[model samples]
Structure formats: structure tokens, C-alpha cells
Target chain A: MVLTWAVIGKMTQRDPLPDGTMRHSRRRVLRVGALLALGGTVPSLTGCEPFNREPPPPDPLAPMVDEALALAAAYRDAATTHPTLASRLTPITEAHAAHAAELARITKVALPSATPTASTPADSDATLTGLRELERAAGESATQACLAAPAERAALLASIAAARASHLEALQ
Target chain B: MNTRTPGARSAHAAALTAEYAAIWAYGPIGVRLTGPAQEAARDAEATHRRRRDTLVLRLTDAGDSLPADQAGYALPFPVTDEPSALRLAVEVEERTAGFWQAAVAATSGAERERALAALVDCAVRATRWRATAGITPLTTPFPGRTA
Candidate 1:
């Protein structure tokens, strides 16, 4: 229930980060409040009620599904790029895909088509370091989401955050 | 933990039992190890002890009935050797994590934060145990999840 400015502030002024670009592109602002109103990329308080043509109120968890899929796509891309390390990376990639699937199931949102163009470093060691950073940020996001989420969904969100942290340890 | 709902109270009580058992389980875990690994068990046990104390105090202050710590907890499996012992350590952490994870959905405010933190700690410890045991795919996608 508590949306700190730090979590939702940047996301307030702009469109939801475009799909497929969240991993590569710099952090995108989310139109969070607007997103809760659904089907609107623009952040407007006045535009929600359009004379009985009411869109369903969006699940706050929908954004999380997108985040999970983006992470999965990025990991899959890394596995493809580093074929020698595919054995190590593939399980983690599968884990992210599972997370995305579960989040989608909970939110009842279809998984977006993910065309991740993740650029890995030339070396496997550096690539792992990069992945660890991504995992760290994603972990923080999931923890914040857990704190702000409803009681019914908090356990799953907390598990996701803990998993992200543990996954980073494996990367080391 | 002045639990507002029965669900929250039940979850906390269950987590309290886990904290007690985890601390007790570490004795056997720490004994069957050497060097850094033994130190890790000691540290983990100390952490559980601290959390358990806090929970007891909070419940007492609220005039809530405190859950009893058992005289001793049985090991999940034989811990006669290093590999078995390490496996038991992982089991203890993972089992303890389940209660805290459940608590996250039952409680709110600072209690929920504490539960989330405990779950993350257990998951990280479990990962390290798996790595030490040379287990592949060192992390679970959803720690503490039965499904």
C-alpha cells in the first residue's frame, strides 16, 4: 500500500518502459499510477472514467510479469551468446521463465512477446558479473513489491526476491 | 508481533518454532564440520537465537501466549558424516524458510519485513550449502514454495 517516491516516482511521468528494451535500455520510467487505471500509457487522473466504457482495473502485479520475462529473455540471450557457458546459464534462464510464467498466471496477463537483444560482454567472467548486477537490482525491486503488495500475494513476491539474491550467489 | 489477525499469529507461532529448531539443529551441523564451514554454522545459529529472543519478547510484551521451544529437535536424517551433515544443514535452512515465507503473507508492517528478511537469509544460506555440496543449479526459483 505504500508506494514510496523512490519506487514509483520516475515511473510517474513517462510511458511504461517499452517491452524488450528494459534490460538493455537504461532504466525506464513507469507510469505506475496511470497503469493502475489500465490501458492508458499517459498519466492522467481525469481520463479514467470515460462514460461507462470502463476498462478493468489493472493488476499492480502486471508490471512484475513484464520484468520477469525481460530477465528471462536477457538470460536466454546470454546463454545463446556464450554457448560454452550454456550449461551454467540455462538453468537460471529456465528459473526466470518459471517466475515469469507464475507471475503471469497470478495476474492473468498474457506473456508479452520478448525480443531481448541483450549484449553480453566478450568474456564469460564479465558476463556473469553483468548478470549479477541485474539480479541484484531485480531482487531489490521484488522486495519492494512484496512490501507494497496485498497479503495474498506477498509470500510469492518475497520468494521471488529471495530467489533472485540466491541466484546471484550462484553466479559468483 | 502484536498480531492483528489469527492467521498472522499462527504464522508467527510457527516461525518461532522454526527459529528454535534451527538453532538446535546447528549443534549437530557445526560439530560435523571444520574451519570456515563450522564457523558458518555457528554464525547461522547465533542469528536464529537472536531472532528467536526478539520474537519471544515481542509476544510476551503483547501478552500473547508464547510457543514453547522443544527440549530437543530430531534430525531429519542421520548426520554421522560431512555430506549427510551438510545435507541436513540445507534441510534445516530450507525448512525454516518456509515458515517465514508463509508469514510474509500473513503479517504486515515491521513483522512482515522481518519475515521477508529471514526468508532471504535462509535462502542465501541454503544456496551456499548447495554450492559447498557441489550441487548443480544452486538456487531454487521459488524458495520455500511447496508448489
Candidate 2:
């Protein structure tokens, strides 16, 4: 009877059982299984922690587009005073709106909630003069953008700069 | 004569056409616009004339047939009122601007820059017209062209 029991034990321990045998061996198997399960869960756990990592900031061009749109709005308001001028300018005004909308879309920015408030220059004539000055500055800024970057950027900035120059001429 | 690309020729032609239209539009634009605005309109006309003259000479030098001035060209519409006149001005600038944009597409280096500058000038004029009309969004998405 004892020989039979020993034979049975040997048969059950086919995978080089440790000295601890039965209980200890089972425990080690469970531990290995647990480790494998843990290993499988690791990638997802790291993925979940993505919020903990820092993200890069948005492109600077986004804000510049917004500013350009705002300036365009100001121009639109001023254009309304002279209907003949306004009619002449309708297409141009429409074009600016389209540009502003496109830039806003590109930058994934919402249209600015507030309209630009014009602090009226002391006199109407003075205001026109001031507007012209502002136009010149805007033209310079647009030209600078072209000078500062890649071909695509340069083209876009150049277009804006030209608009500014046109404004300066009209104001004159 | 040096061989020119189709794009280059097209752009050159477009710029020339714009010059023609600008020269034509100024007559009415100058009349309707008064005071400082009138002086500006006259100056702009003179600028266009100079550009037109330059293009004619350049085309002639290049052995290309230059387009002659027409006795009259149709405006987008009648320029009877100030509003109509301003609108015409905008149309003219935008049309010219589109040509420059085409030029930019055709040429490179200095030529491209010049085309770009011309486009900007048209756009700027459009914006001024917008401002004069009290509209918002002075610079249009596409300045001189439909697309």
C-alpha cells in the first residue's frame, strides 16, 4: 500500500516539483498566473494615466488669425458710412469675412464674442487719419508674417500686407 | 526670346488686365470720392497708369503682343451713387487682386513677391472700401478671385 502511494505522488509531480511540493507548488503557480495577468493590465493602466502627462501648447498663428478677424470687423463698420463706397467695397468686405471665417476654422477658435469698440478719435477727420495710421501698422505686421516663415506663410502674410497697403491708400 | 511657362504668361496677362481695369475704374471713383478721399483716388489712378505703362513696355520688350486701351469698358454696374461707386471700387480691387494671386501661383522669387504685394494692395483697398461703408470684416477670405 505504501509503495502504491509513493508511485502516485511521483506521477502527480511530473513538472520538477519544488521541495515545498503540494501547497507551496500550487502557491507558486498561482503567483505566476497573477504576475502574467498583471503584465497584461500594465499597458491599459499607463494609457489611462495619460492625463497626468503634459501637453504642448496651441500654435501661435491661432491668436493672430483672431486679431486679424477683429480688425476686419472694424473695417466693415467704418465702410457703412458711405453707401457708394460700401457698394464698391461689398465684395471686398465679403472676402474679408470669408478669410476671417476660414482662419477661425483653421485655428479651431470660436469667433470673438465682443466686437471691437472704436474709441472715436476727437474728430471724424481725426478718426479717419487714425484709421489710416492703424492700417499702415497692420500692413507692416502682415508683411512681417510673410518675412518670418515658410513659403505658405509668406504667401498668406503677403496677402494680408497688401490689404493693409490698400487700406492706407483708400484712407489717404 | 526666352521661353515662358503658360502660368507665367497667364499671370502676366492677368496683371495687365487688372491694370487696365484699375485705370478705367479710377475715372468714376475719383468723381464720387471727395476731399481727402478724392486725392487718394487720383493718386491710385496715377499708380495704376504707371503700372500699366510699365507692363506695356515689358510686354513689348518680351515680344509679346500688348493689349490696347479700349474706348470704354463696362463697370460691374452703374456708379450713380456714393454706395454704388464704393462697391465698384471694391469690385475693381478684388478683381485686380485675384490676378496678382494668379501671378503668385505662376512666378517665383522676386516675381512672386511682386505679385504678392500687388495682391495685398488690392485687398487693402477693398478693406478701406469696407470701412468706408461701415462693414465688418474688411479683408475677404479670397480677395480678387471667386475661388
Candidate 3:
């Protein structure tokens, strides 16, 4: 049978179960339906709780934010160590910071205070090389995260992955 | 291949539409570029076409009817020169990435894997186009998102 948009819209508005328990399959349906309805603007499903439900574990999004911040720090530290590369590196660094902020906002979590670990480059060339390595690693991590992320968060993770991949090319 | 979920099937269909557009946009984008840039556009177009074919097969196997492509698509802007062509390339990739992003939110398992790969591919391509255009900050914080 053909799946019409109207049918999917109805699925998203499903009421909570009588006992206040939701099946995994049904939850997946609701999440997908909501995503389609929002046109990908919905950040996360955290706010979809019906009420009286137990809180979830550490937010899955926390790691993504941490990774983004780490990438930003890497770029910033590299620029500081090699001032000549500052012009080329600074904008991307800020982009990473923006990513971290957005991810934190969507996840409804505070930004972590701990500083990210950064490499100390010996020169401008080394700084570019080191940054390339960092971008590659970050891209891989983001791709893996996208693969495992829930439907609600997969788009964000995929975008992060893609951005990092492009960063790798730019560094070249 | 669980086509039982209407959301997943519909999202996949949407992705197919985006892929169709990407393939068509590349025709104009490639002709305006030359040398290595031209080759890159050709490669990008080939990749989109391959993806579109693969998605068609998967959707068919999942028992969903294929959506028809548009007779023609309106270019976001006129592509009268090299720079404009590159910009269109970037826009096409970003637009397609948005559809795959939506698919990621609407599917699971191997289907989700396909969606994620498509999303990432479009994003990376867009970034490369931005670099070619001498657009600074060669990457966006979020590839498929507007806000």
C-alpha cells in the first residue's frame, strides 16, 4: 500500500498508552512522524516525554558537543602557536565554536567548562598538517556517531560529519 | 527494508527527488567549469547519479513506487559564469543534503546508513565548492541545517 503524507501525520499525534508505557516501535514511529512534520527543524525528542517517565541517561548529544569544542580548541591553539596561519585558521575555529553552541542549545545542556586538548605545532606548516589530522579524526568520529544516532539526532550528527570531511579538504 | 513505516518510505522518496535534482543541476555546473574543477563536477555528477540509481533499486525492493522526476527545475539563480556555476553546485549539494538529513530522521538500519552517507557526501561536496569559490570558513557549523 502507498504511504500517504496524511497517514504519517496521523501517526505522529499518537496518544500515550493507557498504562503510560510506550513501545519501542511506536516511539520510533512518533519520532519519524514528528521529524517529517517539522521539516528537520526538530532538534531532539527529549521534550516528547508524555509525563511521569524516568529521566534518560547522560544525553547522547553531550559527546558531540565535546567533540566540536575540542575541534574548535585545536584550531584556536594552532593559530596561536603559528600566527602566520591565523588568518586561514581563525574562521573555521569560530565555526566549530558555533557548532558546539548549537549542539548544546539543541540538547538543552550547558556548555562544558573544561578546555579541549590541543596539539602544539612547531610551525605554520606543521600546524596545517596537524589540523588536517585532527579534522580527519573528527570526521571519522562524526560519521560513526551518525551511524549509531537515533533518528531524532541523526541529521545533526550527519551534518557534523560532513562539515569535518570538508574541513579535511580545505586543509589540503 | 521495512517499508511498513509510512514515514521512512516517504522520507526515502523525498531523498530520491533531491538526488534527481542534484544530477540534473550538475549538467549545467560541469559545463561552466574547466580543467580539474570540470573533472570534479563530472565526478560529483556521476556520484549523484549512482546514488540515485541505488536508491531507486532499494525503494523498489522495499515495495515502494518510484516518484517521477520534474520535467525541469528552476535554478536557484542564473549560472552564466564559472563562479555562478560553482555557487550553484554548492547550493545543489546543500539542498540535497537537507533531504538526506530528513531521511536520517525518518529511517533506520541499512536504510538509515544510506541516508547518512548521502547527507555527508553532499555536505563535503558543498564545502569543496565553497573552497573553490574562495568562500572563507570553508565549512558550515551544521551542513544541512538553516538555523
| Residue-level lDDT tens digits of model 2 in B1-147 | 111666666668768987998898889887988887677677777877887887677667767776667767888789987778778877887788877766765666666666677777677767777677666655555455566
Instruction: Write out the backbone clash pairs for model 3.
Output: none
Query: Which stretches of model 2 miss by more than 4 angstroms?
Result: A1-157, A160-172, B1-3, B145-147
Return model 3's CA RMSD, one decimal: 10.9
Better of 1 and 2 by lDDT: 1
Docking class of 1: high
Docking class of 2: incorrect
Give candidate 1's whole-model lDDT: 0.82
For model 1, state the Cα shift of residue A151 in Å.
1.0
Predicted candidate 3 versus true structure: per-residue lDDT over A65-125, tens digit per residue? 8888988999999888888778778878987898799789978989988878787758778
Ranking by lDDT: 1, 3, 2
Q: Pick the candidate with the highest DockQ.
A: 1
Q: After superposing candidate 3 on the true structure, give the runs of residues whose Cα lies further than 4 Å from its correct spot.
A: A1-57, A117-119
Relative to the real complex, the DockQ score for model 1 comes to: 0.80
Report the C-alpha lDDT of model 2 over A135-162, residue by residue, as the tens digit: 6776676665555545445455566667
Pairing residues by index, what is the TM-score of model 1? 0.82
1 against 2, candidate with superior TM-score: 1
Global lDDT scores for all candidate models: 0.82, 0.63, 0.80
Worst 10 residues of 3 chain A by lDDT: A43-52
